[model samples]
Target: MRQVKHLLADKGSVVHSVSPAAPVIDAIRMMAEHHVGALIVMDGQRLAGIVSERDYARKVVLKGRSSSATPIAEIMTTEVVTVSPEDSVDHCMRLCTERRVRHLPVVDADRVGGVLSIGDLVKAVISEQTEQIEQLQRYIAG
Candidate 1:
Protein backbone atom coordinates (compact mmCIF):
# COMPACT_ATOMS: atom_id res chain seq x y z
CA MET A 1 0.00 0.00 0.00
CA ARG A 2 2.85 2.35 -0.73
CA GLN A 3 1.70 5.78 -1.84
CA VAL A 4 3.13 8.36 -4.21
CA LYS A 5 3.95 10.56 -1.19
CA HIS A 6 6.25 7.87 0.11
CA LEU A 7 7.89 7.53 -3.28
CA LEU A 8 8.38 11.26 -3.76
CA ALA A 9 10.00 11.50 -0.37
CA ASP A 10 12.56 8.91 -1.46
CA LYS A 11 13.46 11.00 -4.47
CA GLY A 12 13.21 14.77 -3.87
CA SER A 13 10.41 17.08 -4.99
CA VAL A 14 12.56 18.51 -7.74
CA VAL A 15 10.54 19.23 -10.88
CA HIS A 16 12.39 20.18 -14.04
CA SER A 17 10.25 22.37 -16.27
CA VAL A 18 10.23 24.46 -19.40
CA SER A 19 7.82 26.84 -21.09
CA PRO A 20 5.55 25.70 -23.90
CA ALA A 21 6.81 28.55 -26.02
CA ALA A 22 10.38 27.40 -25.63
CA PRO A 23 12.14 25.82 -28.56
CA VAL A 24 12.34 22.05 -28.60
CA ILE A 25 16.10 22.36 -28.71
CA ASP A 26 16.15 24.25 -25.44
CA ALA A 27 13.92 21.72 -23.75
CA ILE A 28 16.17 18.90 -24.98
CA ARG A 29 19.22 20.74 -23.70
CA MET A 30 17.68 21.25 -20.30
CA MET A 31 16.65 17.61 -20.07
CA ALA A 32 20.15 16.49 -21.08
CA GLU A 33 21.70 18.81 -18.51
CA HIS A 34 19.40 17.52 -15.79
CA HIS A 35 19.75 13.90 -16.96
CA VAL A 36 15.97 13.52 -17.14
CA GLY A 37 13.94 12.00 -19.93
CA ALA A 38 10.99 14.38 -19.62
CA LEU A 39 10.40 18.06 -18.88
CA ILE A 40 7.16 19.55 -17.58
CA VAL A 41 5.92 22.17 -20.00
CA MET A 42 4.57 25.15 -18.05
CA ASP A 43 2.47 27.98 -19.38
CA GLY A 44 3.02 30.54 -16.62
CA GLN A 45 1.73 28.81 -13.48
CA ARG A 46 -0.27 26.11 -15.24
CA LEU A 47 0.97 22.72 -16.36
CA ALA A 48 0.60 23.04 -20.10
CA GLY A 49 1.97 19.67 -21.10
CA ILE A 50 4.99 17.36 -21.04
CA VAL A 51 7.86 17.12 -23.51
CA SER A 52 9.91 13.99 -23.57
CA GLU A 53 12.88 12.53 -25.41
CA ARG A 54 10.46 10.16 -27.12
CA ASP A 55 8.53 13.13 -28.44
CA TYR A 56 11.67 14.67 -29.86
CA ALA A 57 12.69 11.38 -31.45
CA ARG A 58 9.33 10.67 -33.05
CA LYS A 59 8.00 14.15 -33.76
CA VAL A 60 11.19 15.91 -34.70
CA VAL A 61 13.96 13.53 -35.77
CA LEU A 62 11.83 10.92 -37.42
CA LYS A 63 9.76 13.57 -39.11
CA GLY A 64 12.87 15.43 -40.26
CA ARG A 65 11.75 18.59 -38.45
CA SER A 66 14.06 21.21 -37.01
CA SER A 67 14.16 21.07 -33.23
CA SER A 68 15.34 24.66 -32.92
CA ALA A 69 12.44 25.93 -35.01
CA THR A 70 9.73 23.86 -33.36
CA PRO A 71 7.95 24.90 -30.20
CA ILE A 72 7.50 22.47 -27.29
CA ALA A 73 3.73 22.96 -27.49
CA GLU A 74 3.77 21.44 -30.94
CA ILE A 75 5.51 18.30 -29.74
CA MET A 76 4.30 18.05 -26.14
CA THR A 77 1.55 15.78 -24.89
CA THR A 78 -1.20 18.03 -23.51
CA GLU A 79 -3.46 15.39 -21.99
CA VAL A 80 -1.27 14.92 -18.96
CA VAL A 81 -2.14 11.90 -16.81
CA THR A 82 -1.60 12.73 -13.14
CA VAL A 83 -1.48 10.90 -9.81
CA SER A 84 -2.25 11.95 -6.26
CA PRO A 85 0.22 11.88 -3.40
CA GLU A 86 -2.13 9.52 -1.58
CA ASP A 87 -2.55 7.24 -4.61
CA SER A 88 -1.38 3.66 -4.24
CA VAL A 89 1.61 2.35 -6.17
CA ASP A 90 -0.61 -0.38 -7.60
CA HIS A 91 -2.98 2.23 -9.00
CA CYS A 92 -0.14 4.16 -10.51
CA MET A 93 1.22 0.99 -12.13
CA ARG A 94 -2.17 0.28 -13.67
CA LEU A 95 -2.39 3.84 -14.99
CA CYS A 96 1.04 3.55 -16.56
CA THR A 97 0.26 0.21 -18.11
CA GLU A 98 -3.14 1.21 -19.47
CA ARG A 99 -2.26 4.70 -20.55
CA ARG A 100 1.16 3.74 -21.97
CA VAL A 101 2.68 6.80 -20.34
CA ARG A 102 6.18 6.84 -18.90
CA HIS A 103 5.66 9.68 -16.43
CA LEU A 104 2.88 11.11 -14.28
CA PRO A 105 2.83 14.38 -12.41
CA VAL A 106 1.78 14.02 -8.79
CA VAL A 107 -0.97 16.39 -7.78
CA ASP A 108 -2.12 16.81 -4.22
CA ALA A 109 -4.70 19.26 -2.89
CA ASP A 110 -4.71 21.24 -6.14
CA ARG A 111 -0.94 21.55 -6.10
CA VAL A 112 1.91 19.77 -7.89
CA GLY A 113 3.68 17.61 -5.35
CA GLY A 114 6.12 15.89 -7.69
CA VAL A 115 6.44 13.68 -10.76
CA LEU A 116 6.60 9.89 -10.90
CA SER A 117 8.14 7.78 -13.62
CA ILE A 118 7.41 4.18 -14.50
CA GLY A 119 10.87 3.35 -13.19
CA ASP A 120 9.99 4.82 -9.82
CA LEU A 121 6.87 2.71 -9.50
CA VAL A 122 8.83 -0.41 -10.47
CA LYS A 123 11.51 0.38 -7.92
CA ALA A 124 8.93 0.87 -5.18
CA VAL A 125 7.24 -2.40 -6.03
CA ILE A 126 10.53 -4.29 -6.11
CA SER A 127 11.57 -2.79 -2.77
CA GLU A 128 8.23 -3.76 -1.25
CA GLN A 129 8.62 -7.30 -2.51
CA THR A 130 12.16 -7.53 -1.16
CA GLU A 131 11.05 -6.32 2.26
CA GLN A 132 8.21 -8.84 2.33
CA ILE A 133 10.61 -11.64 1.40
CA GLU A 134 13.00 -10.63 4.18
CA GLN A 135 10.18 -10.55 6.74
CA LEU A 136 9.03 -14.01 5.68
CA GLN A 137 12.58 -15.33 5.93
CA ARG A 138 12.95 -13.88 9.46
CA TYR A 139 9.66 -15.43 10.54
CA ILE A 140 10.70 -18.85 9.20
CA ALA A 141 14.03 -18.65 11.04
CA GLY A 142 12.27 -17.73 14.28
Candidate 2:
Protein backbone atom coordinates (compact mmCIF):
# COMPACT_ATOMS: atom_id res chain seq x y z
CA MET A 1 0.00 0.00 0.00
CA ARG A 2 1.19 3.49 -0.82
CA GLN A 3 1.63 6.21 1.76
CA VAL A 4 0.09 9.67 1.67
CA LYS A 5 3.57 11.15 1.37
CA HIS A 6 4.12 9.32 -1.90
CA LEU A 7 0.81 10.57 -3.25
CA LEU A 8 1.72 14.10 -2.20
CA ALA A 9 5.05 13.93 -4.00
CA ASP A 10 3.49 14.47 -7.42
CA LYS A 11 1.28 17.21 -6.08
CA GLY A 12 3.42 19.69 -4.24
CA SER A 13 2.58 20.39 -0.61
CA VAL A 14 1.16 23.82 -1.05
CA VAL A 15 -2.03 24.61 0.78
CA HIS A 16 -4.33 27.23 -0.65
CA SER A 17 -5.74 29.30 2.18
CA VAL A 18 -7.55 32.50 3.02
CA SER A 19 -7.79 34.68 6.09
CA PRO A 20 -10.79 34.06 8.32
CA ALA A 21 -11.62 37.73 7.95
CA ALA A 22 -11.76 37.47 4.19
CA PRO A 23 -15.21 37.64 2.65
CA VAL A 24 -16.84 34.48 1.41
CA ILE A 25 -16.65 35.89 -2.08
CA ASP A 26 -12.87 35.94 -1.86
CA ALA A 27 -12.83 32.26 -1.04
CA ILE A 28 -15.15 31.49 -3.92
CA ARG A 29 -12.87 33.37 -6.27
CA MET A 30 -9.81 31.54 -5.02
CA MET A 31 -11.55 28.20 -5.43
CA ALA A 32 -12.55 29.11 -8.96
CA GLU A 33 -9.11 30.38 -9.86
CA HIS A 34 -7.38 27.31 -8.50
CA HIS A 35 -10.11 24.97 -9.78
CA VAL A 36 -10.39 23.38 -6.38
CA GLY A 37 -13.38 22.41 -4.31
CA ALA A 38 -12.20 23.70 -0.94
CA LEU A 39 -9.96 26.27 0.75
CA ILE A 40 -8.39 26.26 4.18
CA VAL A 41 -9.32 29.16 6.40
CA MET A 42 -6.26 30.47 8.20
CA ASP A 43 -5.99 32.76 11.20
CA GLY A 44 -2.44 34.08 10.87
CA GLN A 45 -0.44 30.84 10.71
CA ARG A 46 -3.06 28.69 12.44
CA LEU A 47 -5.71 26.67 10.74
CA ALA A 48 -9.11 28.04 11.65
CA GLY A 49 -11.57 26.28 9.34
CA ILE A 50 -12.18 24.95 5.83
CA VAL A 51 -14.61 26.40 3.36
CA SER A 52 -15.97 24.23 0.56
CA GLU A 53 -18.36 24.49 -2.34
CA ARG A 54 -21.00 22.70 -0.31
CA ASP A 55 -20.61 25.23 2.48
CA TYR A 56 -21.14 28.06 0.07
CA ALA A 57 -24.19 26.42 -1.42
CA ARG A 58 -25.72 25.32 1.85
CA LYS A 59 -24.77 28.17 4.19
CA VAL A 60 -24.58 31.12 1.87
CA VAL A 61 -26.66 30.52 -1.23
CA LEU A 62 -29.42 28.35 0.21
CA LYS A 63 -29.74 30.62 3.22
CA GLY A 64 -29.94 33.68 0.99
CA ARG A 65 -26.71 35.05 2.42
CA SER A 66 -24.61 37.44 0.38
CA SER A 67 -21.12 36.16 -0.30
CA SER A 68 -19.61 39.64 -0.45
CA ALA A 69 -21.03 40.60 2.92
CA THR A 70 -20.59 37.34 4.75
CA PRO A 71 -17.25 36.33 6.28
CA ILE A 72 -15.79 32.92 5.31
CA ALA A 73 -15.49 32.01 8.96
CA GLU A 74 -19.27 32.16 9.17
CA ILE A 75 -19.72 29.34 6.66
CA MET A 76 -16.49 27.38 7.01
CA THR A 77 -16.33 24.02 8.77
CA THR A 78 -14.44 24.69 11.98
CA GLU A 79 -13.89 21.22 13.39
CA VAL A 80 -11.80 19.82 10.58
CA VAL A 81 -10.36 16.31 10.68
CA THR A 82 -6.96 16.09 9.01
CA VAL A 83 -4.55 13.33 7.97
CA SER A 84 -0.80 12.94 8.14
CA PRO A 85 1.67 12.01 5.40
CA GLU A 86 2.52 8.80 7.21
CA ASP A 87 -1.04 7.55 6.89
CA SER A 88 -1.86 4.94 4.24
CA VAL A 89 -4.13 5.45 1.28
CA ASP A 90 -6.65 3.11 2.88
CA HIS A 91 -6.65 5.32 5.94
CA CYS A 92 -7.36 8.31 3.78
CA MET A 93 -10.34 6.58 2.17
CA ARG A 94 -11.63 5.44 5.53
CA LEU A 95 -11.46 8.94 6.97
CA CYS A 96 -13.19 10.41 3.99
CA THR A 97 -15.95 7.82 4.13
CA GLU A 98 -16.43 7.93 7.89
CA ARG A 99 -16.29 11.71 8.17
CA ARG A 100 -18.36 12.30 5.01
CA VAL A 101 -15.73 14.73 3.80
CA ARG A 102 -14.25 14.74 0.32
CA HIS A 103 -11.14 16.72 1.21
CA LEU A 104 -8.58 16.14 3.97
CA PRO A 105 -5.89 18.68 4.82
CA VAL A 106 -2.50 17.07 5.37
CA VAL A 107 -0.99 18.40 8.59
CA ASP A 108 2.64 17.74 9.44
CA ALA A 109 3.76 18.66 12.93
CA ASP A 110 1.31 21.53 13.46
CA ARG A 111 1.82 22.96 10.00
CA VAL A 112 -0.61 22.70 7.12
CA GLY A 113 1.17 20.76 4.39
CA GLY A 114 -1.33 19.96 1.65
CA VAL A 115 -4.86 18.96 0.87
CA LEU A 116 -6.05 15.57 -0.40
CA SER A 117 -9.36 15.10 -2.12
CA ILE A 118 -11.37 11.96 -2.72
CA GLY A 119 -10.24 12.01 -6.32
CA ASP A 120 -6.60 11.95 -5.26
CA LEU A 121 -7.14 8.92 -3.07
CA VAL A 122 -9.05 7.14 -5.78
CA LYS A 123 -6.35 7.76 -8.33
CA ALA A 124 -3.62 6.49 -6.04
CA VAL A 125 -5.54 3.36 -5.15
CA ILE A 126 -6.26 2.64 -8.79
CA SER A 127 -2.64 3.10 -9.75
CA GLU A 128 -1.42 0.80 -7.01
CA GLN A 129 -3.95 -1.86 -7.90
CA THR A 130 -2.98 -1.66 -11.54
CA GLU A 131 0.65 -2.29 -10.70
CA GLN A 132 -0.22 -5.29 -8.55
CA ILE A 133 -2.46 -6.69 -11.23
CA GLU A 134 0.30 -6.33 -13.79
CA GLN A 135 2.70 -8.23 -11.55
CA LEU A 136 0.17 -11.00 -11.02
CA GLN A 137 -0.42 -11.26 -14.74
CA ARG A 138 3.30 -11.53 -15.41
CA TYR A 139 3.64 -14.29 -12.81
CA ILE A 140 0.72 -16.21 -14.32
CA ALA A 141 2.17 -15.88 -17.82
CA GLY A 142 5.65 -16.97 -16.75
Candidate 3:
Protein backbone atom coordinates (compact mmCIF):
# COMPACT_ATOMS: atom_id res chain seq x y z
CA MET A 1 0.00 0.00 0.00
CA ARG A 2 1.16 3.49 -0.73
CA GLN A 3 2.09 5.51 2.34
CA VAL A 4 1.94 9.17 3.16
CA LYS A 5 5.71 9.40 2.87
CA HIS A 6 5.41 8.60 -0.82
CA LEU A 7 2.69 11.18 -1.20
CA LEU A 8 4.80 13.77 0.55
CA ALA A 9 7.71 12.85 -1.65
CA ASP A 10 5.56 13.43 -4.71
CA LYS A 11 3.79 16.54 -3.41
CA GLY A 12 6.65 17.99 -1.33
CA SER A 13 6.28 18.50 2.38
CA VAL A 14 6.05 22.25 2.43
CA VAL A 15 3.72 23.24 5.22
CA HIS A 16 1.91 26.51 4.79
CA SER A 17 1.22 27.90 8.22
CA VAL A 18 -0.07 30.99 10.00
CA SER A 19 0.48 32.23 13.51
CA PRO A 20 -2.49 31.77 15.81
CA ALA A 21 -2.20 35.41 16.80
CA ALA A 22 -2.44 36.55 13.20
CA PRO A 23 -5.57 38.26 11.98
CA VAL A 24 -7.99 36.11 10.01
CA ILE A 25 -7.52 38.35 7.01
CA ASP A 26 -3.85 37.50 6.89
CA ALA A 27 -4.56 33.79 6.97
CA ILE A 28 -7.09 34.24 4.21
CA ARG A 29 -4.59 36.18 2.16
CA MET A 30 -1.96 33.50 2.65
CA MET A 31 -4.39 30.77 1.60
CA ALA A 32 -5.23 32.76 -1.51
CA GLU A 33 -1.55 33.26 -2.35
CA HIS A 34 -0.83 29.60 -1.85
CA HIS A 35 -4.01 28.48 -3.59
CA VAL A 36 -4.89 26.29 -0.63
CA GLY A 37 -8.17 25.91 1.17
CA ALA A 38 -6.66 25.74 4.64
CA LEU A 39 -3.51 26.58 6.59
CA ILE A 40 -1.87 25.12 9.67
CA VAL A 41 -1.95 27.48 12.62
CA MET A 42 1.35 27.42 14.45
CA ASP A 43 2.36 28.94 17.74
CA GLY A 44 6.10 29.24 17.34
CA GLN A 45 7.16 25.78 16.14
CA ARG A 46 4.25 23.89 17.65
CA LEU A 47 1.00 23.23 15.87
CA ALA A 48 -1.73 25.30 17.50
CA GLY A 49 -4.70 24.65 15.28
CA ILE A 50 -6.00 24.78 11.71
CA VAL A 51 -7.86 27.55 9.96
CA SER A 52 -9.69 27.01 6.72
CA GLU A 53 -12.05 28.87 4.40
CA ARG A 54 -14.87 26.97 6.08
CA ASP A 55 -13.87 28.39 9.43
CA TYR A 56 -13.74 31.88 8.00
CA ALA A 57 -17.15 31.56 6.40
CA ARG A 58 -18.88 30.09 9.42
CA LYS A 59 -17.11 32.00 12.18
CA VAL A 60 -16.37 35.37 10.58
CA VAL A 61 -18.72 36.11 7.71
CA LEU A 62 -21.78 34.42 9.15
CA LYS A 63 -21.19 35.90 12.59
CA GLY A 64 -20.51 39.34 11.11
CA ARG A 65 -17.09 39.38 12.69
CA SER A 66 -14.37 41.50 11.17
CA SER A 67 -11.66 39.34 9.59
CA SER A 68 -9.01 41.96 10.31
CA ALA A 69 -10.08 42.18 13.94
CA THR A 70 -10.42 38.48 14.61
CA PRO A 71 -7.41 36.29 15.33
CA ILE A 72 -7.01 32.85 13.78
CA ALA A 73 -7.05 31.34 17.27
CA GLU A 74 -10.61 32.52 17.64
CA ILE A 75 -11.83 30.64 14.60
CA MET A 76 -9.31 27.85 14.04
CA THR A 77 -10.17 24.24 14.76
CA THR A 78 -8.18 23.32 17.82
CA GLU A 79 -8.98 19.62 17.98
CA VAL A 80 -7.24 18.80 14.75
CA VAL A 81 -7.06 15.28 13.32
CA THR A 82 -3.56 14.38 12.16
CA VAL A 83 -1.71 11.57 10.39
CA SER A 84 1.89 10.41 10.14
CA PRO A 85 4.10 9.89 7.14
CA GLU A 86 4.28 6.16 7.82
CA ASP A 87 0.52 5.81 7.74
CA SER A 88 -1.12 4.24 4.73
CA VAL A 89 -3.14 6.34 2.31
CA ASP A 90 -6.17 4.16 3.05
CA HIS A 91 -5.84 4.96 6.73
CA CYS A 92 -5.76 8.66 6.00
CA MET A 93 -8.83 8.31 3.82
CA ARG A 94 -10.66 6.53 6.63
CA LEU A 95 -9.68 9.22 9.09
CA CYS A 96 -10.85 11.96 6.78
CA THR A 97 -14.17 10.27 6.22
CA GLU A 98 -14.74 9.46 9.88
CA ARG A 99 -13.72 12.89 11.11
CA ARG A 100 -15.59 14.65 8.31
CA VAL A 101 -12.55 16.79 7.67
CA ARG A 102 -11.00 17.96 4.44
CA HIS A 103 -7.44 18.45 5.71
CA LEU A 104 -5.09 16.36 7.82
CA PRO A 105 -1.74 17.55 9.08
CA VAL A 106 1.10 15.05 8.85
CA VAL A 107 3.00 15.08 12.13
CA ASP A 108 5.73 12.84 13.39
CA ALA A 109 7.26 13.14 16.86
CA ASP A 110 5.92 16.63 17.37
CA ARG A 111 7.32 17.77 14.05
CA VAL A 112 4.90 19.10 11.49
CA GLY A 113 5.76 17.51 8.17
CA GLY A 114 3.03 18.26 5.69
CA VAL A 115 -0.68 18.71 5.22
CA LEU A 116 -2.96 16.55 3.07
CA SER A 117 -6.16 17.75 1.52
CA ILE A 118 -8.97 15.46 0.39
CA GLY A 119 -8.14 16.32 -3.19
CA ASP A 120 -4.62 14.96 -2.73
CA LEU A 121 -5.87 11.66 -1.41
CA VAL A 122 -8.43 11.37 -4.17
CA LYS A 123 -5.85 11.99 -6.82
CA ALA A 124 -3.52 9.44 -5.30
CA VAL A 125 -6.25 6.84 -5.14
CA ILE A 126 -7.13 7.43 -8.75
CA SER A 127 -3.53 7.10 -9.83
CA GLU A 128 -3.08 3.93 -7.81
CA GLN A 129 -6.24 2.41 -9.30
CA THR A 130 -5.15 3.28 -12.81
CA GLU A 131 -1.82 1.57 -12.30
CA GLN A 132 -3.50 -1.53 -10.88
CA ILE A 133 -5.89 -1.69 -13.80
CA GLU A 134 -3.08 -1.43 -16.30
CA GLN A 135 -1.14 -4.17 -14.51
CA LEU A 136 -4.15 -6.48 -14.50
CA GLN A 137 -4.78 -5.83 -18.18
CA ARG A 138 -1.17 -6.63 -19.06
CA TYR A 139 -1.25 -9.80 -16.97
CA ILE A 140 -4.42 -10.99 -18.71
CA ALA A 141 -3.00 -10.23 -22.15
CA GLY A 142 0.18 -12.14 -21.38
Candidate 4:
Protein backbone atom coordinates (compact mmCIF):
# COMPACT_ATOMS: atom_id res chain seq x y z
CA MET A 1 0.00 0.00 0.00
CA ARG A 2 1.85 3.14 -1.16
CA GLN A 3 1.20 6.25 0.83
CA VAL A 4 1.14 9.88 -0.34
CA LYS A 5 4.35 10.45 1.60
CA HIS A 6 6.04 7.72 -0.36
CA LEU A 7 4.76 8.96 -3.70
CA LEU A 8 5.84 12.55 -2.98
CA ALA A 9 9.22 11.56 -1.62
CA ASP A 10 11.14 12.47 -4.76
CA LYS A 11 8.91 15.43 -5.56
CA GLY A 12 9.52 17.00 -2.13
CA SER A 13 6.93 19.03 -0.23
CA VAL A 14 6.03 21.82 -2.60
CA VAL A 15 2.59 23.39 -2.28
CA HIS A 16 1.86 26.01 -4.90
CA SER A 17 -0.38 28.69 -3.41
CA VAL A 18 -1.91 32.11 -3.93
CA SER A 19 -3.81 34.62 -1.87
CA PRO A 20 -7.58 34.48 -1.95
CA ALA A 21 -7.77 38.20 -2.60
CA ALA A 22 -5.67 37.84 -5.71
CA PRO A 23 -7.25 38.37 -9.11
CA VAL A 24 -8.39 35.31 -10.99
CA ILE A 25 -5.98 36.27 -13.76
CA ASP A 26 -3.07 36.14 -11.35
CA ALA A 27 -4.03 32.65 -10.30
CA ILE A 28 -4.26 31.61 -13.92
CA ARG A 29 -0.86 33.15 -14.66
CA MET A 30 0.72 31.37 -11.73
CA MET A 31 -0.72 28.06 -12.84
CA ALA A 32 0.66 28.63 -16.28
CA GLU A 33 4.09 29.59 -14.92
CA HIS A 34 4.19 26.52 -12.71
CA HIS A 35 2.64 24.30 -15.37
CA VAL A 36 0.13 23.08 -12.81
CA GLY A 37 -3.61 22.65 -13.14
CA ALA A 38 -4.51 24.08 -9.73
CA LEU A 39 -3.38 26.51 -7.03
CA ILE A 40 -4.15 26.43 -3.32
CA VAL A 41 -5.84 29.63 -2.25
CA MET A 42 -4.60 30.82 1.13
CA ASP A 43 -6.16 33.36 3.45
CA GLY A 44 -3.24 34.15 5.76
CA GLN A 45 -2.40 30.77 7.29
CA ARG A 46 -5.66 29.07 6.45
CA LEU A 47 -6.53 27.14 3.34
CA ALA A 48 -9.32 29.31 2.00
CA GLY A 49 -10.07 27.55 -1.23
CA ILE A 50 -8.64 26.19 -4.49
CA VAL A 51 -8.59 27.62 -7.99
CA SER A 52 -8.16 25.60 -11.14
CA GLU A 53 -8.30 25.96 -14.90
CA ARG A 54 -11.69 24.33 -14.88
CA ASP A 55 -12.94 26.99 -12.49
CA TYR A 56 -11.73 29.69 -14.82
CA ALA A 57 -13.41 28.07 -17.79
CA ARG A 58 -16.71 27.51 -16.02
CA LYS A 59 -16.95 30.67 -13.94
CA VAL A 60 -14.89 33.26 -15.75
CA VAL A 61 -15.13 32.44 -19.41
CA LEU A 62 -18.48 30.73 -19.62
CA LYS A 63 -20.18 32.95 -17.06
CA GLY A 64 -18.66 36.13 -18.56
CA ARG A 65 -16.79 36.96 -15.39
CA SER A 66 -13.75 39.12 -15.88
CA SER A 67 -10.60 37.29 -14.84
CA SER A 68 -8.78 40.55 -14.17
CA ALA A 69 -11.59 42.00 -12.07
CA THR A 70 -12.84 38.81 -10.43
CA PRO A 71 -11.26 37.66 -7.21
CA ILE A 72 -10.05 34.06 -7.14
CA ALA A 73 -12.05 33.52 -3.97
CA GLU A 74 -15.20 34.18 -5.93
CA ILE A 75 -14.62 31.22 -8.23
CA MET A 76 -12.54 28.90 -6.05
CA THR A 77 -13.98 25.76 -4.58
CA THR A 78 -14.05 26.37 -0.85
CA GLU A 79 -15.03 22.91 0.28
CA VAL A 80 -11.51 21.72 -0.32
CA VAL A 81 -11.01 18.03 0.28
CA THR A 82 -7.61 17.01 1.62
CA VAL A 83 -5.33 14.05 2.22
CA SER A 84 -2.66 13.23 4.78
CA PRO A 85 0.92 12.17 4.34
CA GLU A 86 0.17 8.79 5.81
CA ASP A 87 -2.93 8.37 3.63
CA SER A 88 -2.76 5.51 1.17
CA VAL A 89 -2.74 6.20 -2.55
CA ASP A 90 -5.89 4.08 -2.84
CA HIS A 91 -7.63 6.33 -0.34
CA CYS A 92 -6.70 9.43 -2.32
CA MET A 93 -7.83 7.79 -5.56
CA ARG A 94 -11.20 6.96 -4.04
CA LEU A 95 -11.60 10.51 -2.80
CA CYS A 96 -10.73 11.91 -6.22
CA THR A 97 -13.15 9.52 -7.88
CA GLU A 98 -16.03 10.37 -5.57
CA ARG A 99 -15.44 14.12 -5.52
CA ARG A 100 -14.58 14.44 -9.21
CA VAL A 101 -11.55 16.46 -8.16
CA ARG A 102 -8.07 16.10 -9.55
CA HIS A 103 -5.99 17.71 -6.81
CA LEU A 104 -5.84 17.26 -3.04
CA PRO A 105 -3.77 19.15 -0.54
CA VAL A 106 -1.84 17.08 1.96
CA VAL A 107 -2.40 18.58 5.38
CA ASP A 108 -0.93 18.07 8.84
CA ALA A 109 -1.95 19.99 11.95
CA ASP A 110 -4.04 22.31 9.80
CA ARG A 111 -0.96 23.22 7.79
CA VAL A 112 -0.58 22.46 4.12
CA GLY A 113 2.39 20.16 3.51
CA GLY A 114 2.06 19.34 -0.15
CA VAL A 115 -0.34 18.68 -2.99
CA LEU A 116 -1.26 15.50 -4.82
CA SER A 117 -2.93 15.07 -8.20
CA ILE A 118 -4.61 12.15 -9.89
CA GLY A 119 -1.54 11.93 -12.12
CA ASP A 120 0.70 11.37 -9.12
CA LEU A 121 -1.44 8.53 -7.84
CA VAL A 122 -1.54 6.96 -11.30
CA LYS A 123 2.24 7.16 -11.64
CA ALA A 124 2.81 5.55 -8.24
CA VAL A 125 0.37 2.77 -9.02
CA ILE A 126 2.01 2.12 -12.38
CA SER A 127 5.46 2.02 -10.83
CA GLU A 128 4.30 -0.42 -8.17
CA GLN A 129 2.71 -2.63 -10.78
CA THR A 130 5.85 -2.64 -12.90
CA GLU A 131 8.01 -3.61 -9.94
CA GLN A 132 5.67 -6.44 -9.00
CA ILE A 133 5.68 -7.74 -12.54
CA GLU A 134 9.47 -7.73 -12.64
CA GLN A 135 9.63 -9.62 -9.36
CA LEU A 136 7.20 -12.23 -10.62
CA GLN A 137 9.16 -12.66 -13.83
CA ARG A 138 12.40 -13.14 -11.90
CA TYR A 139 10.82 -15.71 -9.61
CA ILE A 140 9.41 -17.64 -12.55
CA ALA A 141 12.82 -17.74 -14.24
CA GLY A 142 14.47 -19.03 -11.08
Clashing pairs in 2: none
> Compared to the true structure, candidate 3 yields what TM-score?
0.98
Cα lDDT tens digits for candidate 4, 77-124: 999999999999999999999999999999989999999989999888
Better of 2 and 4 by lDDT: 2
Q: What is the lDDT of candidate 2?
A: 0.94
TM-score of structure candidate 4: 0.98
The models' CA-based lDDT, in order, is 0.92, 0.94, 0.96, 0.93
Model 3: C-alpha RMSD to truth? 0.6
Q: Which pairs clash in model 4?
A: none
lDDT winner among the candidates? 3
Off by over 4 Å in 2: none
In candidate 1, where is summed lDDT lowest over 10 consecutive residues?
106-115
Once fitted onto the true fold, the runs of candidate 4 whose alpha carbons sit more than 4 angstroms away are none
Name the better of 1 and 2 by lDDT.
2
Q: Kindly list the per-residue Cα lDDT of model 2 for residues 1-142, writing each as its tens digit.
A: 9888998998788899999889999999999999999999999989898999999999999999999999998999999989999999999999999999999999999899999999999999899899999999999999
- RMSD (CA, Å), candidate 1 to true, equals 0.8
Candidate 3, 89-140: lDDT as tens digits: 9999999999999999999999999999999999999999999999999999
Score every model by TM-score.
Answer: 0.97, 0.98, 0.98, 0.98
In model 4, the worst 10-residue window by lDDT is 4-13
